[model samples]
Target: MKMAKIGLLLDEQTANKKWAERENVFAFYMKEVLDHFGIPYQVISENTDPMEEMDLLIAGLLNESDQAVQQLISYIKNGGAVLHLSDSPKLARWAGCQVDCGGPGYGYPAKELGYQKPVRFLKTNHWYRAAPADWNAKEGFLTDGSPEGPVIGELWMTIMAGSGKMVHCQADLPYSIVGLQQGLEPIHRDGVPAPDGTAGIDDGLLKADDSFTMDWSCDRETTDTGMNYFSEAYADRWREVFYHKLAEMALEKGLTVPFIGRWPAGIDQIATISHDSDFNLEESAEVTLSLLKECGIHSTWCMIEPGYESGMYKKIKQEGHELAYHYNALEVENGVWSEMEFKRQLQDLKTKTGLKHFCTNKNHYTLFKGWGELFEWCEKEGIQLDQSRGPSKKGNIGFLFGTCLPYFPIAWHTEKNRKYDVIELGFLTQDLNHHALADTTVIEPFLEEVQRIGGVAHFLFHQLHLLEQPKVGEAFRKVVREARARKFEFWTSEQISRWERARRRIKIDRLAPSGEPELSGEAPTASPVIWVPVPKHANVLGEEAEIRFGHLCIKKIPVFKQAQTS
Candidate 1:
């Protein structure tokens, strides 16, 4: 019935402590995750009573004193909930057992997290150094039976000791929250201006215009990961099951998971197809466009070549596809007047084609490199969308910003506060992820995964992929066909961008304890869509919630409450 009141407890003594340190990436991540899911939490002072003042005390307090650990033990024994990271033996002790801290400390999955292998729950393979808590796998015996470890790993375990629950996680939930400990660019010794971070708003040339700057590097994603040797952009990739449950464990009712997409009628996932052209002039440009045209779909093409005289480029524009500018990073790296060239090329394209607005772009090689200069130029040119922040890695489509959805990139500096008027559509997966990067032929598995997740699948297929091989085009056709079969509505880059623009306006004003859940917001589209969490707890049990766009009722679905943990 109420939100979880989370607390980041200080050590017993409050001297020389900074919980928001860069090294405390996990702490930052936990805060972001809590905010992302609308879970409210506060920082508790060490002098406060954990049993009284807090429903759950996040488990970093144990690092301070034996007395602190004893307090934690006492709190849990009396039914207090806590979630602690690291391979600390204190967790095993809380479970009335000892921890084995001598196991492998790399990324690995807790086999029991999901029903499928390669489940979205990716960890550093760190094992809790000991036998399975409360159970003997070798002897086939049980030590205790009341509160079993649902997420049982040799590295971590959750114990229902007394009335309290303790999740001893060794794989480091912080890393999961913020991929690759060093998410932010290097900050100065004084922690003022990060290396790639803007020196001042003026240096970034960020003006007081109608611009909304977004730091995709530090914002909420539906779910994101960019760890080496793994991917975090799978469908339904919200992998904080244990942490989420732990938060709910503190709540008497249950948890509330936000619905991600803005498709009409509560569609779970959105589908997109795009192409970024590099030097593949001879690439299968015609075949790809023809295929999309035949399938009755429009896409966005990031163009680099000057195709003023080319019929194919004209056909691309005439077919209702969007022409997004593509800037080459190699030219920038090679000092080839890259910025100037982009400006000149933009002018040339407009001059030749009489195109009014070049509203979208993707870096030829994702050379954004955390700079405001390029964005400054983009602002001057009136580009409304940037698709460069999609990948966490150069070649892979892992979770960089923890989401593949579109968001207004906000950039803030100490000297000046500014919002750049640009929507960043982070890339999800691309043709290269399989063919060019991994050299795989069949992308059925990848497409299947995208449909399974039911989020935006922004695929970047360089027409060049199908230059010599018709199979590439055919395979992409299969992607479209299969998506249609699954009820996925295809959209061009501009269409999706417009949808997001309208979606930002759709809002949930409040959820009442009775009556239809009150919603607030306007959609410019004729058949606009929205998803809102139902009236929670008992208010949701006897009835369903209705969602709408203007006078049109889009959905009247039952309120399916999240799994009640407590």
Candidate 2:
């Protein structure tokens, strides 16, 4: 039996033009998620791509191209499984539905798919409303307020077409994922006040909070008045649903979907501890460094300009931790958000420490302006990762930027298919010690959810508060203990950057006759583990790996195999 693979049909001409105009590149974001999960797939074009060779097809159609529509309908009619990622009228008609785009707004999942957070559907021309009774939807989106309200549209529906299945999404899946993660184009600064003495807002700059594009007011009845999301990592759960559906569809077709697990050696999940050196205080930095060493974990210390004495830098390097850059773009500190200023601080950190390279950076006060500009600067500076997109206020702590995983952001206002080289690992929140709202309780749930979805759980701390604030020190210890209890490995930002980049080079060569996937590429320092979803009675010819999440019998395979080229 031939192993199944996912085929992503992308309308490049239309997607390219849309991306250039700062529109959601549906294909790009969909592919981004697939690549992030290490799902093996082939990019197909509508004109001459072979659809029969694919076990499942994900159609990312941006326009109502007649040729593409006809091709998809024919493929589905001829017993081909299709997962449509567009609201094209022709494709919707084939799925027995009508397109009633009742303008852009928030949408709630009518039925729970393990995630109940309202997904944002703010795309300009392609927003949707609930499908009518005639649509015969299996699962759909509801009005923002309640699931009993008017049906917005089908969230996930399947129709049997010519002995095959057509799974459809009413809203644009790629757009929703991209919008939730990257956030909307910042128009004005959000007026939310920062913590006392914090430089989050009122600084006359577009801080990270200003870029929040998710509707925090959607599902807030359960939480206290101060909190926004009922739960965190909304995008992470939604992505898991997508992955589950893919596995379900593949299983239905008597096939298995293969992907590389996020972490190497089958670690349950990953936890990263990073400290922002705001004041460049040596004593506080030493305190945190000692605590980390005591816990037997390596961390990333983001250094501000004139960061530490040369000896302090040498000490940090001598330890198993990472010395990174902390870009000071806060105006109150006389910082400027200019490219020249970014370069100056980075250069200063490098010069002072005699460090030839810095892999990660987090802006002072989580400051950010515009879309993709900070990412562009990081890429230009040869920095591999950034951590400036998390929440600064109390209400929005977990998954504020919609994900804890490291993702390469796409260029919104630039040329087509342009994605930055830098990886964004948005921290969950800063200093769990400061607020009653964000305390030690947030750590376990966040790590659980991240483990459930095979992503990272990044916790941020401040060097100044570690010892001066005893509660802060306690909170840090609690995080480490809980994560360690859950078998989560602690890694530095540089380690994550290197691992992600290395895993991206890995590709599924082919399925062996024994039902194991053959992988090709240079394995990371820790060998990569490939996950294969095994159906009942279907043998997975490999060692069964223990993972924290998923009901399916996921088998793990080695990553050092050579490609079996025909």
Candidate 3:
């Protein structure tokens, strides 16, 4: 069986424009999702690019012209698969129904999809109101539970054209994904905190969660009147479900889609333990460092103003841990939030600690203002990774930002929709067993999900809490041991940033006519692996190959090919 060649179809008119300026930026976001999954694909414009070469096609948004629609139909009829993301009534017609605007409401997965709760969409989702051309065409629907309740919405409609098929999802999936991941521009600065204290929205300051587009009351799933674990990473699950559908389609076509594993070789999952040295107490930090050493973990320590003495800094560095900066904007004695203030703190960290670079940073109070401003500052200051997007209150403790994966934010508000240089690695929660924080209860499920999805799970704790709170220290030790038992490798922010950057540099050059994948780029450190769903009897060219996580994991993609098993 030949490896599948996937192409992301784009509109000819918008192909040359900046993603933000393009009439339909969904395809670019589709590309972003693919890149995050480490899937191999190419961009093909509707006018000039030939579709005959691709086994699978993903349309960011459809080119709704008659000729384009007819051409896509013909391709599908001839056995090419398509997973269309846009809401096209014409395409809906082929899928056996007419589409209409359905949801400004939440979308709960059908029982068969195996999801626990409903996920919210930022925009109106596509729904089929008309009688279907084919009664069996609709495979997935968002149904309201009342016995007399109407079937509110539909997610996927599978239409088989002669020898092939097309799965049309009426929802603006890419838009939802991007919106949930990066969040909306923080224009609404009204300070009104949650009554239950799940979110401290009344503080009269901007923060990362403030930029969220979803309504906190409706979007977040809460327990005990919003005082515990808030919600699952709905956005992350959406991505996972979408990818599984794509993989299923490819397998049906006798093709396989290979992707980059989130962690390095043999590591089931990865985690980062980051501490904000809030009081800059040498004794507190020393106790925390000793605890980390006992656990055999190397963590990232974000230093505040008037950081530990020179001796403490040297001791930390000598112990193989990472030194990072914590920017305070609390408006206390020296608290400020501005580009100038940010730079001053960064420079101070460099001068005082004698640390040349601070690749990772998290704000003092998770302080943020406006969309993309912090990102722009990060870009200017050479910060490669950020950890400020996470749950600050005890009530909102899990996947509040919608992901555990690190991603580059799109300047969707900009004229060109440019991408930033930095990656945002949103933490799941902060400080276990502390005031306004969930204890180890938040850890097990969160880590389990990350392991299932194969991404990094970042845990944040203030150094003061570890020393002052014994239960918090016990919780930290338990988390480290549990994560290790689950085969999760503990990493520093610098290490994570380095690995992700290096991995992004790598690309699948092409899938050869002979069905082997050709890759190009500098190899990532610690013997990272790429996953391929090799057809039974297919041979892969890699130094070591084994089947794991439902795919074949290859440590090194050897330049030569091997004969198929007899």
TM-score for each model = 0.59, 0.88, 0.86
- Per-residue lDDT tens digits for candidate 1, residues 260-325, read 234555465566777876554733677776788788888888877554355666877888888878
What are the per-model numbers of colliding residue pairs? 34, 5, 3
Candidate 3 colliding pairs: 27-60, 193-202, 394-436
lDDT of 2: 0.72
> Which candidate model has the greater TM-score, 2 or 3?
2
Highest TM-score scorer: 2
Q: What is candidate 3's lDDT per residue for 345-364, written digit by digit as tens?
A: 89999999887778999987
Error of 3 at 80 (Å): 3.3
Full candidate order by TM-score, most accurate first: 2, 3, 1
Between 2 and 3, whose lDDT is larger? Answer: 3
Error of 3 at 466 (Å): 1.8
lDDT of 2 by residue, 1-566 (tens): 34577898877777666766777564567777788778878888776677777779987763467776776777788889987767677766655556655434544443434444555554422333354354444454545334344555556666777777787765655665666777656535654443333324454667776766554445222233333332555566556657766776787887777777787875757899999887888899889888988888999999987788898888988998899999997887889989999999999888898888889999887888777788888888899999888877666677666677888887664546467899989887678767443666667667776776667889888988785777888988898899888888898999889999998988877778866667776656777777776665554445574421243556565648654566
> TM-score of the candidate numbered 2?
0.88
Best of the two (1, 2) by TM-score: 2
Score candidate 1 by TM-score against the native. 0.59
Candidate 1 local lDDT, residue 12: 34
